[model samples]
Target: MNLTLHVNSEQETLDLAALLATLLEPKDVLLLEGNLGAGKTTFTKGIAKGLGIETVIKSPTYTLIREYTKGKLPLYHMDVYRLEDVGGDDLGFDEYIYGNGVSVIEWATFIQDELPDSYLTIKLEPTGEFFEGRNITFEPTGEHYEQLVEKFQKQASEEGLI
Candidate 1:
């Protein structure tokens, strides 16, 4: 299924992340897609917050991946922006993607072939006010993801996060 959201500000986006967080469970993979300044990382910060992570969230542009726990579950945030290598074995993708935690990967397009069969992908774009507004669309790949989206949608409606 597909869902779209128009965020008027950064806070709105964060609220959306919080809403989405309620739907996520351990061992789930979230593929975030967007251009620079599209608020991919910003949205992640909100998700981490809703996940109950205490540390500040920042884009792992250079670090490749950042792990945030202390929330409902462990969050494995990854950014493969600079990855020029693609080895089915060395990537150890299953370690995190299939591990006992929630995985959020930025620039996941780089390793599209490495992604699991089931995942949640969000594509973000600037609608207006440049960096002030964002249009994010989510796509669910399986029953698991569909349930996640439905749960988020229902909770968002009840919480007015939508």
Candidate 2:
């Protein structure tokens, strides 16, 4: 299933992500696609917040993967942009992707071949109306992710967030 949501400000984006975070489970994989300044990390920060993570969230661009285990479930944040040139075959990503936590990958296309069979892909784009405005689309590749999106849409609507 696919779902799209519009947010007029940064806070709205964070709120929406936090809402979705509450519905996630272990082994849930979220692929974030966007331009350089599309707020991918910001959305991740919200997910960390909802997951009860207390430390600051930073982009894993250089480090590749940053694991936050203090949250309700460990959050494996990965930035695979660098893999475009080097490849990702030796990263052992499966350990985290199928681990007892949620995995959020930025620039996932670089590691397309390494991805699992199912996941939720989130695309973020600038609305061009305001600096912080964004149009977020959720695309699910499996029944579990489909249900996750459904619950997220329903909860977001009930909370007047979408």
Candidate 3:
């Protein structure tokens, strides 16, 4: 199944991401595609919040991967934007991507070929300057992802998150 959401505020976008945290399991990967200021990291901030992570959530653009254990489950947040000139493998991103946490990659389009088959794909595009509105697309690539679609859609409907 596929799902789409239009978030009108940065908070709504994060709420949606937190809803996803409830549905995600270990080893789940999310390949986030978007341009800069597209809410990829903002969406992830909600994931951390939803998962109960207490540490600050920031882009790993320079660090490659930021691990957070304060959440319900571990979250491996990665950013590959700076690596367009470098190689993903050189940074050993595969290890974190395939690890036991929920790996969320920002600017993941840069390394699409390396993405796993069971991952969920999220595309966020700017629709306005406020950063509150977005054109979002969700594509799940596995049975686990199907559950994710069901859960989030139901959550959205129940919470009016269209």
Show where candidate 3 strays beyond 4 Å: none
**Per-residue C-alpha lDDT of model 2 across residues 1-162, encoded as one tens digit per residue:** 799888888899889988889999999999999999899999999999889898999999999999999989999999999999877898899999989999999999888888999999999999875555898999999989999999999999999997
Provide the clash count, candidate 2: 0
- Where does candidate 1 stray beyond 4 Å? 84-89
Roughly what TM-score does model 2 have, to 2 decimal places?
Answer: 0.97
Clashing pairs in 2: none
Best candidate according to TM-score: 2
What clash count goes with each model?
Answer: 0, 0, 1
- For candidate 2, which ten residues in a row score worst on lDDT? 126-135
Which model is ahead, 2 or 3, in terms of lDDT? 2
lDDT of 1: 0.84
Choose 2 or 3, whichever is better by TM-score. Answer: 2
Q: Rank the candidates by TM-score, best first.
A: 2, 1, 3
